[model samples]
Target chain A: MEVLAHGLGGRTDLPLDAVAAIVGGGAAVAASFLALTVAWRRPRLRPEGGRPVPARIARALDSPALTWAGRTVALAAAVFVVVVALAGPGGEKANLAPWALYVTFWVGLVPASVLLGPVWRRVNPLRTLHDGLCRITRADPAGRWPIPKRLGYWPAAAWLTGFVWLELVAPHRSDPRLVGVLIIAYGAVNLALARVCGRDWFTRGDGFEAYSNLLARMCPVGRRGDGTLVLRTPLTGLMRVTGEPGLVAAACVLIGSTGFDGITRTTYWRDNVDPGSLSAGTLGLAAAIGVVTVLYLAGMRVSAALTGEAAGELPGRFAATLLPIALGYTVAHYFSFFVLEGQMTFILASDPFGTGLNLLGSTGHRIDYDLAGPTLTAQVQVNAIVLGHIAATIAAHDLALRTQPAHRTVRGQLPIAVVMVALTCAGLFALLSG
Target chain B: MRGVRLRTVVMAVAIGVAVTLAGCGEPAAPSGGTGGSGGTSGTGTAKSAPATFTGPSRKPDVTVVSATVSRGKVEIAQNGVNAQGRVKVRRGATVRITVTTDEADEFHLHGYDRTLKLSPGRPGTLDVVADKTGVFEAELHHSGARVFELQVS
Candidate 1:
């Protein structure tokens, strides 16, 4: 049981009981079937109209002054973090860099994007740095060559995989020096690439940006097709997720790795597998992610055969629906950790340099574990999984209305339905089983 | 709407399944009620305010497991040999983790962050109340040797 505490391996929520997991998976499947049967035949979620905010309000929110100020603040924070990471105290306890990256930025990005809609893009320090350098050199911020259309989100998927590997498989992942080096390296590579690839590089290239943008698609607040800022149901935002190339890979990477993380938490995994073995970790991660991809592709193939749609197109066609499932897995796996250790992010932020000087007087409290009870945590986990399944089903059903012929819609969705159910069960079982 | 009717049907079937399955095992709801003084333990109540820890009146039900570390090798034995696995128990059970190390090491229980300092040729005991639920690792913090995991549900 030599399970090295994964970075921020603080507190894990208690596993769900068999009954809850079963009931959840059962209810999820049942509701999804019912939804598919009763859902509207026509494509209901149009990309056009939502409750549009006033133009003046939208302008104020997206104003240059606000953007510049936010970017400047973000740049300053980035500079401060780099300084602390390079020069501050070394240990996990004293150093603030690891917590800032893993806890605040990595884990915190989920809720932030879900709530605030692509908040990172607005405040990405790397983007700001590129813009500043470009301005200083009197160069165009958008670089010379436009990013190729065929390369949709593939780089994002690759970089996201790299990051997931770093988080879950890489040795010394918790080391402050490693974190600093990673940050610097990631920045330098992306900044240099951004210089040549134009501003669209970050949209489809920067892994963090892609992840933020992916999650933000489910946010209620977003711009419509005409660039009108509108408030709508979160599911409607999900409807807007295009089945572009590599979208499936990105979603699979997110959810599959989360499932792998869940597996690592299990006593069975810890006992049988070498906990600290990098090869084992990498193999398990790849296998988990591969299982998801294989299942999805297989489901799509079945659905395509039944519906007479191209198999290649179906994976992309239905990729948007996976977002909810991805969100579900994320919420189930990391919700407790974020709620509990997320406190450390803010606390450490106050004394960023490992110095006694507290910029914000917020380091007075410790992580309140009892804030999230085991029962509530279990409920959230199961409910999130169930709800995510339901949402994905509905989205698939609706998208099916658009993609598949009217006669073939139900038949085509049957396979995807099974896929959703299987994925949901796999997720629930991962939560419950040791 | 057909959806409305299906929803009702689904709920009824779910209830039926739940009732049928309840006979097989304990209800999957939170059932641990061994709260010492935290009186809000009817169903894992939201513990916000710091309650005074009044140690229980009844004798603590203790589950003891011991480990021996010698020359970078760990041998965990509960009662016999080669039985090192997750020590699982219901919430509120007391677990006394005993460890004897050939070298100086500190056993750190994660999640609870409880620590027990151990020296050579001396066995150290750390008593932990399984108040919180989760899988927590007991590791030699310095050596990063994870001895065992405690699973409290």
Candidate 2:
């Protein structure tokens, strides 16, 4: 019982349920932090523009397998496919929180361009679309496109908006027929925009360019080779930009999570209620877009920080220092849901579908399969998730610091990470135990 | 560096405060108002407190709207009623209920203190008994008005 109360195991009140939540919860935290850190700050020591370059653009474009346009369209198409598949009729519900699916996307996109060393120019979606559409319609897709210095990038913004709409607005409509119409209407909007801007505008935006450029700054200062990078911005500006965005992203995450939860509630339960059919899911979708935009803005801020100058404006500096704030947001947002839905375990265990999703599963006969029952190992799985992310962040931060002198290590940062992780674990354990 | 450390300390303290505040919303003491306690109503004995029921009844009009071995689950269409001639209750008979509302309304049995208010088209159920035995009203309410009713004995 003491272990149940203070340990990662959720609660002694409900023995079976606590087990799953503890392990899984712990692991999720650890994995997310670690993955983000490792992926962001790992040093491959690649040489920057030091290699003798063939002076031809043609030489750069001469990869046999994929033209730049081909790759951009392919990536976009892949994203589209995954989104549709996951949110589609029979697809799993979109619960990509501290979990793998969400982490995977972050991991893939973050390190992809940097690890591969600035392929953004080639895979620029705008350029790809311009080329692809031209070939498809046999029309000239290329013109001297003006790069607007003030214009915020649109690819992530648009994608984020579309996702919000799906989650909030479209999901709530009770009439399947109306939902189909709205989807078609949304597709039309995308098509029209693609037609007007020529696919390149959407694909080859300044966002990824900005990202890659920022990453380049973090490379070795004067190490002129295949493995060096340079930092260049004012520390104050970098700090201001990086700090706000991360916090904003954390806020967005909370909003997004809540919005999705609301949408799910309304669509599956509330809308189906006898009198509330007048509501539409569009409002929720709009809210989701807002949340996602905040996330994007935050992401851009991180990119901006990487580009910012000063040796102290390094990855480890942020990782070791600012990680607690980030982790704090994570705990607040996720725990909100945990508090709301955690009791579902008890409800479902006693009588599956005592409320909500259970009604749909009723088969006259009481089936033995109960999803609400949390086994002992399930606790481990949950905790493992939390633990994994923290560990990953620490490892990543440590690795980034390796690029600098050991004496210069901001030792204070390590304690911050440990304290945050420990506090979170302890609190979570209390919740489970209680 | 010390100043930065101080800021970190302040932030940590802030987080701790927020978490403590959040913890206040944890589940309250379990009230033990669980569903499914059943007993038969004594005929004509109107109790002051809310009525509850268990066991079977071979009566008409008073129906158990659920699917269970105790009470054969019968379908009641929108704005329609089931044939109310006979009802048989089981021991420890929880009147397993399955109600699907096509609109927002409250399903309240006038004789029972319990009432279930559901959203439009949402389905929900609760277990209570016809504890008191007398003429009673099963009322469906909407926006604070009684929309429909069923007679119970």
Candidate 3:
């Protein structure tokens, strides 16, 4: 049904899943292209008007929408709690899966929080309250980061670890209510911790801002202050703070400990029902998350290093070597999902729950992909997900490198990318058919 | 600035209109039961299934087509036409039951056992006999409220 919906032949019904995969996959590649291009061109391609721009600290103080969204989510959690209470333990009538909610929230954050600034600043209650507190106390909340810079990577690590524990270890992967409870609890805890970390967590040093700035060097730095965008390069060195990174380390420690505590306490209950029977599968998922995170971090590191080099040169001289590895990982992980979870293969297509396959848009303009058939899965493996990501990253770097040398356009590399995409699709077709 | 506001307002209006339209269209409710409770087992036969299991009724969208208890076998046929349906058994040891649905729905016998997804136009069955007996509800799930009742000894 999923394959038919995302039919091989292009009809009016249009395979939403396939189109989504292409567009989404394509966009990620495009971002990589922008990054690479910036690197290749070096310092010269830096936007004409915006260079050596003095850091504007005022805008940084303004809250991001993400923070507001988090608060709003926390508010709505009231509804979930009410439902759970009324529904009771034996009340399995309603289908509410919290795991799905967690996936959606984090997935949304990845591109925004990681690739861009938190964007939640405008709506962030914590920031607003922190600023107010600072004003009332007449203290410098911006001087020292509450947390340490070294502890910056812990959130992502914690996120990865949490997924491992919930999906793999604590069992009840199939239980919607349990999953929902976990998400609510996690959110509540994060919010509470953020309150303790205070405003200094962001303003103290380069922290997330630094990582974002490094990410910016990879792509054509978009016009800043042209109105907020879902995507923006992080401000550089926002993460680097001098004094005690204690508060930050404490936050990480708290998160990690809680995750472990949740596992230990829940393990007994899980063992009784024991859904995630295959310990190997659990390990594989953990490994996959680690691999993806490392690959992503590595890609960023390479982009950063290349940016440091002289202008008008190829960015990341060695980035191309990692493309195949990243691509291979994408294929392996996605295929693993298909092999392990028989039901989730066509998840993008069918909303057995009435969600529908047209996630991004209406029927004619959907952007999802059909993972129903081997052919489609192969297409995703080679062309869209894996190879596509590599192409984009490489393309971005190349563009950055070639941005200099007025005569030499990165346009030449476009052909290579096209060829690679075609080759990937062809390879996928062959593999899937075979 | 005008363009941004306009876009936001337009998007909001569009969403509102879509939502309103969605609300207007009524979901296929359990009109009533068509078949008898048990023509095969010589029990009572039902003609007109409830036309609509209206507001907060005990049998809201509920239907129990058949129920039987023989020497060591208990059989029950149910249509997930309503939100909640009930089944009463006389005496059976190892019970085997079958459930069929007219459209795509779920058949979950609450308290007795787990639920299974029933494909459209296809029937799904769950079979379990009593070892420990306390009255339990054989409930069918609708959207909001689930209609069910006590399975008396």
Candidate 4:
């Protein structure tokens, strides 16, 4: 009922076998790049060729009634969780707040966005709350000051770093009372900021919004420039990500924090370098993010040297390629917990306040850990990491050719390919050895 | 014409990786103490991969392990000097863990939800069957200090 101390979900994933899996993952990444060099001679994915979805389906999706309904339901869910978390039973088992936030909402966003394309933007409760406040007060949605030109996505990146730290390193993070206070404080701050910065601020400032939108770049379903719902190659969606300010920072934070999370669970870190205090944990998380940021910049610098491109802009230019890898790391790390804890949340939601009443009647069902056995899970994890690397390599290679002449494309991508292999191997080794 | 060839290359890469994934070991079920040898296997899973799932073995071989809590630190039995935060046991084996604490606390094995109340001098025992394969943390509830994770595979 209390689950584990550091976070939710009592049973953590089994460590991967050390030798074979890491070697396989690294070699697979290397082989994919090498194979791509010989055959994938030029950029192929059509970024402008999204076949428009049928008009009727697009109209249904665009319907204002559906949009309002979605926003209303999402707001209601948020309020319900907040109320129960604040006033409900203290036990995590009886309280649905922490589970809903961590498993059902946060981890669930990955797959949901991958499949449905940034559903959070459509259903964000904060946006609705802000709109309601504005309409009631008859205040202009657009504020007096323009959001600074240099600000770009830096706010989003900072919010993301803050959120990951809370999820991964914050002490007593799983407690419902703490969760309630934090979410309320977080919502209030964001709402206040939105009121000052205007409606468009949420697009580049809210952490969850940016997180979902980043991942949605990998979704096959997307809207064209004209707002028509269109179906495109998933890679094309990824290829279209522009190198906006803080784009690299956001990507690095995502990949690095995930990498840090994998490292924390390893036996080597726990036994050898166990940081005793919260300050130590905060430092470790920062160090992990810093390591990833430096490695990525170094890779881009080398890419510039080889391609004869300007060194200053290469990191931003290639930042879009990291999205697939980030998604892969996310899936590899959180999917199993999502499946197991998601069911637990469903059952707990049936009794939001630990009252005897089972609202959804799901409390009668049991949480089945057998949904994924160890062997099956390990294979999936390994495959997810390896597949992510291959996709990244493909994206990088395509972008290289598209950005410049084909003559130096393969050579320019070689350094990045090496970097990808190193990241993939380090990730696998850390996960397995732990 | 080029698109078809490029797709072929991607397919080849995917198939090659799938083969590698298949070669990766299952970590458990193989070379584990499934033969009822009663601790003879002793973590020697370095041998050939049988790739076979052995049937249900003899009675749950209960391993008696203990931990002592003092000076606000937990010292697990036989896992000192280089503790990996857990004791490894093959799935299907039963473990009977005993703990003595300087503080009044309750021993909780999560996932299994097995709990035992502990007094300052009096020890408590939690008997668990490692039927599920994963790492479950065991902790002292009141102090919230971990008493070694149970790594069942």
Index of the highest-DockQ prediction: 4
Writing each residue's lDDT as its tens digit, candidate 3 over A151-228 gives 654453355455535533453443556655665565455444545565545332222222222222222123344432
- Ranked candidates (lDDT, high to low): 4, 1, 2, 3
- What would the per-residue lDDT of candidate 4 be over residues A169-264, giving only the tens digit for each residue? 887778889889988998898888888888778888888888898888777788776777888777777675346788889998988888877777
Runs off by more than 4 Å, candidate 1 = A1-6, A240-242, A362-365, B1-59, B70-84, B89-93
Docking class of 4: incorrect
- Candidate 2 on A325-390: residue-level lDDT in tens? 323323332332232222222222222312234332321221111211233223332332344234
TM-score for model 1? Answer: 0.87
Which parts of model 2 have CA positions greater than 4 angstroms off?
A: A1-133, A142-155, A169-171, A195-388, A395-434, B1-95, B98-153
Share of native interface contacts present in candidate 1: 0.23
For residue B129, give model 4's deviation from the true position in Å.
1.1
lDDT of 1 by residue, B1-153 (tens): 235324323432332333222221111123333322233222111333434564552244667678888876777775444556667767777666778898898887776666778889799876666777777777886677778778888
The clash count of every prediction, one per candidate, is 0, 102, 61, 2
Tens-place lDDT digits, model 1, residues A167-258: 88887787788888889999999999999987779988999998999888777679887788997666677674346888989999998988
Error of 2 at A127 (Å): 11
Model 3 has a clash total of 61
Provide TM-scores for the models.
0.87, 0.36, 0.39, 0.88
Chain B TM, cand. 2: 0.39
Clashing pairs in 4: A266-A434, A267-A434
Q: All candidates: CA RMSD in angstroms?
A: 8.2, 17.4, 16.0, 7.6
